[model samples]
Target: MAMMKLEHVGIMVSELERSMAFYTDVLGMELVGTLDHNTPGIRLAFLSYPGQTAQLELIEGYADRLPDEGQVHHVAITVDDIEAEVARLRAKGVRFLDEAITTLRNGARYIFFAGPDGERLELFQPPRG
Candidate 1:
């Protein structure tokens, strides 16, 4: 019935490994995991405080160019029930970037929708036990 919490913020990077080092080695965040993204040519790495769930997702090979200020791919929010949330949003005329929901290798499901200013926003449903 409501969004659970902010899942993670996705950022576009030109180099996945470099960004991973900077975030983990320099910032002291722990590398939670990495995955070959479902999208071709794209890679993903997650980092966060040790023993905690990942709070940042770094993406590479998504785009050839990123602005000097950096690009935020999207802000993800966790939802208890993705299907219901999607339906609710659709009823309000929310614009979705894609029609199908994507399930990750770990069983996490997500879908992206356009925000008010066309900013990307994602709704994530973690794997259910």
Candidate 2:
């Protein structure tokens, strides 16, 4: 069998510029590159995490249109502090989909949010002893 690793998670956004500000300025992700596709009137921007192996790909499709509801599946990122991260994001006007932090069977804490285009994104931190 071959080994597999996650390269990036693609999120379809309605506003590329707004999403860029959030991911790059607020979240501190590096903008690696961007591609403009005229045929579909969409643009794709790739972001890389510093000192990490994964990336977040943002897709802005048809500047004048919005993606259908329930289009985004979800993207989860492991954070160092769930509360602190949530606070920081909240201060930046980020809204959470749920009020309470979700705890998994393995004792991990997480929260979800809707991105610029309504893409579901998650921030999580594992419990410690």
Q: Name the candidate that leads on TM-score.
A: 1
Task: Residues 1-129, candidate 2: write the lDDT tens digits.
Answer: 111244456677888889888999999998887777434666867788788767786878744555576244467676777778788888999989989787754465767887898777777564577
Model 1, which residues run further than 4 Å from truth?
51-54
The candidate that wins on lDDT is 1
Candidate 2 regions exceeding 4 Å error are: 1-3, 62-129
lDDT of 1: 0.92
lDDT assessment of candidate 2 = 0.72
lDDT tens digits, residues 26-118, model 1? Answer: 999988889997888999998898876648999999989999999999999999999999999999999999888999888899999999999
lDDT for 63 in candidate 1 is: 88
